[model samples]
Structure formats: C-alpha cells, structure tokens
Target: MAQRGGPAPFPDNPFQDPAAVQPRPGPELDAYNPFESSAPPYQVPSAAPPPLPAAGMPPPQAAAQPPRKASPTEPRNYGSYGTQVPGREKAARPPQGGPRRRREPQGLAFPPQASAAAATAELLKRQEELNRKAEELDRRERELQNAALGGTATRLNNWPPLPSFCPVKPCFYQDIPVEIPADFQKTVSTMYYLWMASTIALFLNFLSSLAWFCVEPSSGSGFGLSILWALLYTPCSFVCWYRPMYKAFRSDSSFNFFVFFFVFFAQNVMYVLQAIGIPNWGFSGWILSLIALRKNTAVAVMMILVSLCFTAVAVLGIIMLKRIHSLYRRTGASFQKAQEEFAAGVFSNQAVRTAAANAAAGAATNAFRAP
Candidate 1:
C-alpha cells in the first residue's frame, strides 16, 4: 500500500507479537485514528430510534418495549397497555335507532303520582280526625242540653218555676208580684166600658144631627155646616177620648186618666155644638179641638159619631184608670214600707208567720215531753 502524507509509518518487527502491534503511550497515540474518525469527536451525529406505536396499534418498525413500572404518584392506564388494571369501561351504548331502555334509580324512588296520593291520603286522614272531633263535640253539646232539660228528677224538681204576672189573673196561674195595684185591672176595665157606652151615645147624637141637616139644609148652613160638624166631632173624639182612653186602660195611670176625662168632656161640648148647628161655636170648637177629621162629608159625619162614642168611652176609662192608679200608688207605698222594714231587719208578716210556726213546733215538743 502506498503511504499517505502524514506521520511516518511504524517499522514492521518480526519479533513483535500480533497483540503487541497496538500503539505505545505517547501524544501521537492519543491522536485520532483515520478509520475511527468519521467526524470531529465533539460534533458526532446520533441516529434516532424508530417512532412509537399508534394508539390501539403495534409499533410500525420496533419491537414493543417492556412497560415502565408506574411511579407511586402515577396512575396506571391499561387495556391495550400492559401489566396494569384497566380503568372502568364506560357502559357501551346501543347505536342510534335502537330501542330505548328504561333507567332505574339506584336508590329508593317515589313517583309524582304516588307522592300526590300520599298527600291526599294524609289530608283525608286529617279531615276524618277533625270530623271525629266535631262529632264528639256535638255529642257533648247534646248531652249538656239533655242535662239542662232535666235529665235528673232531682234537678227538675229543684229548678225555679216560671212566674206568672198577667192582669187577667187566670186561675191556675203562678202569682208574680206586679208594680200596679191589684185593683188596677178591674178599674181600667170598668172605666173603659163606661167610656165606650158614652162614645156610642155621642155617635148616635151626631148621626141624628146629620139626619136633621139632611131634612133641613136651609135650617143650617147646608152641607157646609154638616161637613164642618163632622170634621170637628171626628178628630176631637179621637184626640180627647179614644187615644187617651187607650192609654189609661193600658197603663192605669191616674194622670193619664185625668187628662182623658178632661179632654173627653171638652169634646162632648164640641159635639153638642155641632149637633145644634151653632155657627161661631161649632167653628171655634172645630178649630180649637185637636181632632184629625177627614174632609169627606159622609165619612166625616160617621167619623165624628164614632169619635164621640170613643170620647165617652175614654172618659169612663179615665175614671176607672184614676181609681186603679190610686190603688196602685197606695199598694206601691205599702210595698216600699214593707221593703224598708225588711231592710231594717224588722219582723215582717212573713217572718212573724215563720216565728209562729217555730213556736208551735217547740210547744208541741214540750207537751209531748210532759206526757
């Protein structure tokens, strides 16, 4: 071989061993060898390894490597991967257009309808409870009512009886004390009857006058005078006698009775004037008397007669009422005296009666002992 332009070649030695043909220790020995040196030592290029396997596939050019051991902090993923447990597989879903499946709750579940039914049942139960309470209350009320209506004989017997206080004083009636005197009723009746009779008589008298007027219109102021008389008598009768008599009979007041008598008498005078056809007198009577007479001729006349009769009745009624009132006044005073005596702790008739009964009982006991 031809030598290259470089350091001189070493001499071949027959005595040297083949292994000993290596370079000796020197700076020249540390120099780079041509066969070993393709490039600068500091600047050599390295060949890259083959690409990794695609997901779910084997590597294209290299044999698969043993999987690296997982660090404690690293999670292991396995399946196509090696030597590691696989993550939970997602449940495989059916493709679209497949029949839908119902999903059930993993835990206890209540349907809306079931919940509503439960609420409704609870409400019904509550209503039933309330109804039961109401029924119990009603039963109690009825029981109380029955008790009050004398469920026990003793209770019935002990209850206070109703008081009777009618002026009629019917037989078999309970006697409740009244403010009016006992005689008031009788007096009022008597006076009322008398006044009634008087009123009838007065009415007849007025009618007679009307008849007289019909027979001789010229003798009086004609229909006008008759009408006037009717007007006067009618209202006067009511004002003087009827109304007052009613009051007297109803109330038995002496003052009312007195007033009734006074007004009735005055009315009588007016009626008399109307009957006689006294021009100025009848007019004045009509004007002065507080009679509410109607304007119609026939009605007025009738009313007048009726009023007159009522007036007479009222007068009699007044008298009776006065008597009644007087009796009542005396009775009231006596009652007041009795009340005062009772309040003062004085022995009343009732107390005396009681004392007498007690004394008689004592005496009887003494007599029996002596025997």
Candidate 2:
C-alpha cells in the first residue's frame, strides 16, 4: 500500500463516500422551494374569552379595507411617493437655498435695451463726458505744474511760460517745473542743454553705427541695439536727473538732496565713460563713428559733431556735479533727519499695517474654528 507516490495521496478525496457527510436541511430550505405548498397560517391558542361591549351599545361594523396596489405585471403606475393624487394638486415647494428674490434698486426698472440710433447717441454722450473729464484733468495737471514752477495759472494766463533754448518746436522741457534757486538756474539750465546735446549725439552715433555695420558685418547687431538704446535712454536720462534734482530743490529735503547728489555723481562717472567711446559699450554706435573717421567723409563729419557733443557732456557733467555738491552743502542736510525719515517710512507704512492686521485676524479665525 505504501509502495509509491506518498501512499497515493489518501485516495485523492476521502470524503467522496456518500455516507461520510450528510447536509441537514434548515427550516428556510423548504420556504425557498417554489413548487412546495404554502404553509397554513399561524394560529394562537385561546386562554380566556374576549371582552364584550356594554349591553346597551350596538356591535361595531367591520373596518373598510384600503385598495390593493398594482402587481409587478400590471402596466399602470401609481406614481412615486411624493407625487400628487388624481383629485388634488400638490402645493409648491419653497426654494431650497432660502429666499430667492433680489431687491431692485430704488424700485426702478432696469434700462431698456437701446435701439441702433439710441446706442449711437449714448456712445456720443459717453465720449463727450470722457472729453470733459480729460480736459479737466489736463487743466488741473497744468495748474499743478505751474505751481511747482513757482508761478500761478493767473500769472501765466496773460503770457506763455518761459521759452526753452532747444531748437525743436514744441519743446516738452520748456514747461517742466524746476524749483531751483535763481542763483542755480543758469547752471541747471545748462545741465538740461547738456541732456539735449547728449540726445543729439546719440542720434548721430545711431546713424554712424548703421554705416559701420556695412564696414564690419560682425557688429551688425549693435546697430539696432544702439538705435533702441538711444531712443529709450534720451527720455529716461532727462527724467532720472531732472526730476530728482527738482524734488531736491522743491522740498529742500536732506534725504532727497543726498539722493540726488549720490545719483548724479554716478551719472557724471557714466558721462565720462561714454565720452571715452569704448568699443562694444551700450554706446557702441559712438565708438564706430570714431573708427570710421578717416575712411568715410560723411562719417568723419558726423563723428566730429558727436565727439564735440560728448566732450561737452563730460565737461558739463563735471561742472554740474560740483554745482550739485555745492547745493547739497547749502541744503542743511543732517544725518539725524535722514535716519528719522528712513525709520518713519519703514515703520509707519499703511500697507504693512493693513497686511499685518489681516494676517492676525486670519490666525484668530483659524484658532476659533480648530475645535
């Protein structure tokens, strides 16, 4: 019997014999059989007689039965649980998210959609309003500019503002407010002329750079960059120096005066660098003009003009820097006041306080919600 294959695995299944296991039927097994007869209704054993109504009262009639529901095979629908009955309408439901009505402003009806002609008229009216606003803004701005220049609209109403020395018509710098002292006006005005001279020099250099691109194709990209730089730098240079200087004079602020002096000092250094005509500087255009001096007659003429302008800027920049230094000396700037201004600007800023308050309120709200 134990000859091979671990005694033949005990006959592969010892329980295959019918008598080895018997499945006893539970009470529910009979209930699941569809063909089985239905069981008799449950009956209770009577222990005593039921109570009777009083002798004087009549016996009660049987209660009426409710109608039967339709069978699953029937096609008729009784409707869902909340559906209205045949004889009566259902009441409307209140809106789920509470009150749905919006109050109109002042009980006025909304404006009607405009016809084509009405739309055109409305557009014209709006444009007129905008034009009026624009004119008011321009008048107010001009008045402010005049006030800053130490003149009044009333005084200048009879005559135009002071004329500028620039050759261009409608010179924008002519109306700009400069609040410098009468003694400093000549130097300041010359400084402005220097800015114009610098712009002219840059334009001349821009032209020369285009010329140089033909001579040396390697630097062709510099031509466009130079043109762009000249266009952008001219207006920016005026604002950067002139506005700061004006503020310094107008407020006589020690902090502002120091700022102007420091900034313009750096600017003077830049002027010297530009006058040197360094190759591949952002002002490479000026450098090319110098290189083309001997080869091209027209370029030589342009170079000579730009060279004179650059020299003038360098000389005038040095003079203006010195004048600004002298003005700073007279401004009564003190170290203590500068420190006070810095402290106040940092600590008393309204935006910083508002942000801090909002952060604290958010933290408090989160804390209240945590538990």
Candidate 3:
C-alpha cells in the first residue's frame, strides 16, 4: 500500500475501541477528506440553571431609575434658548401654598387713608424727620471738615492757592477780577471786539497789498513788507499797547497810563501815516494810485480803494480814541494819581539802577555836541 500524510482512519464509533472512547467527529467525519487535518472543533460548555429564590424574599431593584417629570413652576436647568443639558436636572420646586399678597417696591411707603388733618399731621411729621436727618448729616460734615482743618474753619494761616493753570504766585491774569471792576468788564469786552476788528482789518489790508502786487511787480516788496508788518503788529499791539491801556483803565496806575499813552500815540501816528500813503514806507497806496493812474486805470482804482479803506480805518480809530478818552475819565485816572503811581513805580522798578548809566551816556553825548 502507498504511504499517506494524515492520521490513519479509525472506526466511527468511539465505544467500539478503547482508544476511540475519547470524543470523535462521528458520522460527520465522512464529509471531510481523510487526508486533510484542521484545528479541533470548538466546544461550548453547558450553562448551569439559575437558583430559585427563598420563601418570602422579593427580587432586588435595578441601580438606574428613569428621570421624573418636573412641575410647571419648577426652575429648569436650561441651556441656550430652553435647551436642557444632559445629566443635569432642574432644582426642586418649593411646595405650593395659599395665594400670595402683592408686595410693593422697596423704599416706597404708602400712607393710610385717614382724615385730612391726620394726613397733614403725618406729612408734617415726615418732613420734620427728614429735616432732623439733614441737620444730623450737616453736623457730621462740619465735624469732619473741622477735624481735617485742625479746628479753625477760616483759612487764616494757609495762603490762598494759585490757580491750577498758573505755576507761579501773583499771576496778574488770575488777579484780573480784583484789578478790573465788574462795571469795566463790558468796556473790556468792547475793547476785545475792537482789537479783533483791527486784526481783521490788517488781514484785509494784506489782501489789498497782494492785489497791488498782482498789478505791479514793483509793489511786491511793499506787499511783502505789509505782510511782515501785519504778522508783527497784530500780536505786538494786542499784548503791549491794548493790554497796557486796559490795565490803565482797570486801575488808575500812572506807569501803566504813561505806557499806554506813549504806545497808543505812536500807533495813531502810524495809522495817520498809512492813511497819508507816504513814499517808500511800504504803505503808500494813495501815492502808488496817483502814479499808476497815468499808466493803468484798473491798478489805480484798486490802489485808491485800498487807500480809502486805510483812511476810513484811521478816522474810525480816532473816533474810538475820543470815546475811550471819555471812558478813561470814568476810570478815576487823574494827573495827581498818575504822578504818585509814577513815583512808586520808579522806586520799585528793577531798571532804576540802569537809568544812571543811560543818563551819564546822554550827558557825554550832549557835552560833545556842545563843543
């Protein structure tokens, strides 16, 4: 016989042979080829039967229970827009009771309905209580302030503090109220308007000068000089002359008056010169007009117009000066007062020591000229 690879075939009945008494495939092994071998068939263990319960003992309940439904008034653990979160439950609701009395808002009191006299008496009683409370508060505030201030209410020792904006003591601008009278405030306001108008006039004069420059290139220097004058004179006149005049009128100070007079006289002289239109002064619009008339009529007309404007301004200023003179009388400024003020200023001035040097120089010049 030929040799084979698998185990030799045996009897199908395991009980027939002592070796075959072990578990076998039985008749099912016939379906499989005798030469082929595979892993042993899976064996399932038999399940044991459950035990019966003892008498009178019940079955145990499950660990997890279903969620209970919430009452209508109970607060829910809602997320966004009434969506409930998983595993989170609503809070337990309070037990329902009898109908609730409507509560009024806090701090609002309702008086009882009584006779008119009784109501009036109640109102008066409340008012008196409020007054007593106010008095108590006021007393406490006073006590606190007194404690902070070391007993005295008046600022006897402490110097009056300078204004927040001012970094130094004795700021004249801060002292404006004390120096300038309330009645003179209106006058100062008027003066401010006048000052603003003069500044505007200067600008207009510059524009006119520019127009002249457009007509003649020779007039360009004059226009440039006019511009320079406007820039310089605007701030100078406001600060130096106008302010000094205002101070003079505010207080009858002789030094301030003399300062104002000298500066104002010079200013008036310049205004008159501007109106006259003198040659080579950079403001000779009238002279320019007369000369240009022979050449260009348009240029001449423009110059004449500008010149007339200056003349009008000068005349108006003269009139305003006259008005200011009348107002100055009301300021109580007199020759005697001015003399006293001048003396006081001379004594106090830092420049008084330098005066002797100037006087000696002047004397030397005079002595040289005399020979």
Q: Looking at model 1, report the run of 10 residues with the lowest lDDT sum.
A: 170-179
| Whole-model lDDT, model 2 | 0.67
Backbone clash count for every predicted candidate, in the order shown: 9, 0, 0
- Clashing residue pairs in candidate 2 are none
Candidate number achieving the greatest TM-score relative to the actual structure:
2
Which regions in candidate 2 have their CA more than 4 angstroms from the true location?
Answer: 1-183, 282-290, 345-371
The per-residue C-alpha lDDT of model 2 at residue 330 equals 75
Model 1, runs deviating above 4 Å: 1-182, 222-236, 252-258, 268-371
Superior by lDDT: candidate 1 or candidate 2:
2
Checking candidate 3 for backbone clashes, the offending pairs are none
> Which residues of candidate 3, in runs, are more than 4 Å off?
1-179, 284-305, 330-332, 349-371
Tens digits of per-residue lDDT for model 2, 1-371: 47664546356677984546766778887568554434443458699965787899987765795655544444775665455677676666778989877877795764566466788899999999999999978876776677777665343321123356744443232333334556767766677677777888788778767766676677666677778869887877766776667655655666666666777777777677666666655453255456767577675566556666777787888887887777777767787887777677666899888988999999999999998
**lDDT values of the candidates?**
0.51, 0.67, 0.68
Which tens-of-lDDT digit does each residue in 128-151 have in candidate 3?
Answer: 999999997776577557646677
The sequence of per-residue lDDT tens digits that candidate 1 reaches over residues 1-371 is 65788655554674575557765688876785645634333435469865676799955655685644544445656553343357754556798998998998787788899999999999999999999999977755664566567563322221123345633332221111121235444553454456446545544545544544554454354334545645565545555665555554444444455566677557555544543333323231232222323334553455455445545444555455466446546634344453454455435467777998899999999999995
TM-score of each: 0.25, 0.47, 0.43
